[model samples]
Target: MKGLVIGGGVAGLRAALDIANAGFDIYLVERDYSIGGRSAQITKSYPDLTNIKDVLKPLMEEVYNHERITLLTNSEVLGLEGEAGNFKVKIEKKPRYVPDGESCEKCIEVCPVEIPNEFNERLDKRKAIFVPFSYAIPDGCVIDETNCLHFKDGSCSRCKEVCDGINFDQKAETIEIDVGSVVVATGFDPFDPNLRPELAYDKYDGVITSLELERILDEDGPTGGKIIINGKEPKSVVFAHCIGSRDKKVENPYCSRICCMYTAKEAYMLREKLPNAEISACYIDMRAFGKGCEEFYEEVQKKQVLYRRGVAAEVYSNGVNLVLRAEDTLLSEPYESAADMIVLAVGVEPKEGSSELAENLGIKMDEYGFFVEKNMYDPVETEKEGIFLAGCCQGPKDITDSILQGGAAAAKAIGLMGRHSN
Candidate 1:
């Protein structure tokens, strides 16, 4: 049996490795130029203290070495046809704009445009021809066709000219493949803060999302681990939870599982960095439902991290510092405070293309946009016989949960392969 997994993230990679090891040929497709997914964007993971790459690298290495797995990057599943066991897939592969002959990242330096790098979440910019991040598993350069001058107009093919004619101008290509099974592990997107007008996302300089905060704390991130606000050092900090989630009236109603833990992690992280600084968490209710979660919350509170149980009605700027006016429902009083920084514990939503792909493939999607499947007997199996779901593509799940689900999906696929061979 042959299988295709539609993501290169932790879950997809894990599933690919598992299926390949079971003697089934596997094809792992990653939309991005690299395969780390959102997991690669993080620093050290909480509770385990494992570096993001440390957990991912070994599996990535296995995927690289595995003869049965075909990994494709900057490629997308344009369309899907046929039934579970015998499926025809059409994929669109974006041109790399660079020849495989002795490639180097020098093409990035020659290009002058600096676009808001998605890997850095606009905290930094990358040249048009550049890798997503430093540790991109392949650590190779990718051409941002949308941003490249050549793609913009044929006149300025600086990347091609500077390459000493080693550059290839092959047009973006599409190809078709056949697989017996498929696994959908496409991940989720963070709820855009711009959707919340009350928070004034674009207007505030100090306010950012948990993801932006991660970049700030990361050694490779924008600030280089300094909690600097608009290039100035400010004292107090506030983390607001449920920005665009857990609300039936406004944004998404579902509780984003990772927010509570990440919020606690941020509080602890901030306190560790600036011991004397004031750090507060404004939340409706703290949910720590993991092995060491409650204890970790205790540790944060014990370290003088203020856990305010309430919702911020509005956030506005008073003068130099951003003012947050929130009622501490626990205390039954209106409280206003100022902070150097504010981090919104944003929620994750399905990736942009998931629903469209589901329809094209005749799969189903839940109202929330995550792929819906026959989860009763085996949670990961999809409505289609050989298709499986894993990672945030199924729903909002943490990294550990994603990894575990990836393994389970692989087992399901392999079990099917085993039965088919018999």
Candidate 2:
């Protein structure tokens, strides 16, 4: 029996690997031009601050090369029918106009159109014909139809002229596959800090979100991992925690499990990169709940990173620094900290179209829009039989938990198909 994994993030990749290794045919569908998902955007994982790409790239290569797995990047699930052990899935495969061979610099040099790179949180621009990242799977250029000159007015075909690989006529294709079970690992969207105007995320150039900081810290990111604000290295960096999570103002009352840990990790990274810079982590509560998390927090504390118990009230840009206003709960007093930069510790939210996808799949979502599990005792199982969820698509979780759930979902899918003997 075959299995359909919706998403190509860590959880989906893990599930696909497990099922494919068990000798079952697996169809992994990803909505982006490449897989890897948000995890790929992360520079490092928490607790150990391990290089995320070092750990993930090999798994991605395995999935891409696995014989039992049919990896479909730039694809989406159009429709699904039937039940366990015999489900027909219709997928819409979008095109990446660049040809099959490795993407080269020739096409990029000729492409005149430039647009903000979404992968880099729009911190930088990229050519219309560009690879999503240096380590992008399929390792090819994808045309941004929305921004391509040829698509706009048929004005420029410079990329096509320079590179024989360009195919402007590439069209979307639909494919049907029969699978025994479905694993929804669609993942989560970073809480948009723009929603909280008080944070001044977009209003000020010095203010950025945690995810944006992740990209900025990445060696391959827009700034090549330099912690620069307005063309200058930040002398002081302030982290504002819980911008989305545990905030009744935004209707997201649940704790986004990773924010506290990731914020700490970011603080540690900042300390390492800017040894003499002042750094403070303003938080409501220190939730170092995971293994080695508390120790990591302690390490950051030992680095002289300040941990302040408070909720940031507002942030305004000064001529030279961003003034952060907040109340220290422990001190029972209000104070303002001036910083060269501010990073909002934004929370994770359900991915866009999650509610609609849940409806389409005949599943349920929690009030917060996360896919509801069968029960608290069995979190991976959805109310719908033969359907499972892994990663933030189900709830806010760390990468380790997401991978564990992926494996659990794979086991459930295998049992549902009665393939234990295989």
Highest lDDT against the true fold, candidate = 2
RMSD of 2: 1.4
Candidate 1, residues 1-422, lDDT tens digits: the string is 68999999999999999899888999898898878789888876775557777777777767866999988888899888877667899998876666433247567778888989788788888898887776675556767878877778755666766676335466778989988788889999999988877886788989888998888878778788887878876689999988878976654899888898888887887787888898998999988888888888888889898888897677898887898889899889999889878888988898998878898677889888988868677789987888899999988989889988999999988887677656
The estimated TM-scores of all candidates read 0.96, 0.98
Give the TM-score comparing model 1 with the true structure, all chains together.
0.96
| Stretches of candidate 1 exceeding 4 Å from the true structure | 99-103, 165-168
Would you list the C-alpha lDDT of every candidate in the order shown? 0.83, 0.90
Pairs clashing within candidate 2: none
RMSD values, in order shown: 1.6, 1.4
True-structure lDDT of candidate 2:
0.90
lDDT of 2 by residue, 1-422 (tens): 78999999999999999989988889999998888988999999999989999999998999999999998988888777887777888898988888755476788988888888999989999999899998888788888888999999999999888888778898999988888899999999999887889888878888988988999999999999998888999999999999999988898999999999999999999898999999997999999999999999999899999989998899986676799999999999998999988999989999998877887678899999999999989889988888899999999999999999999999888788775234
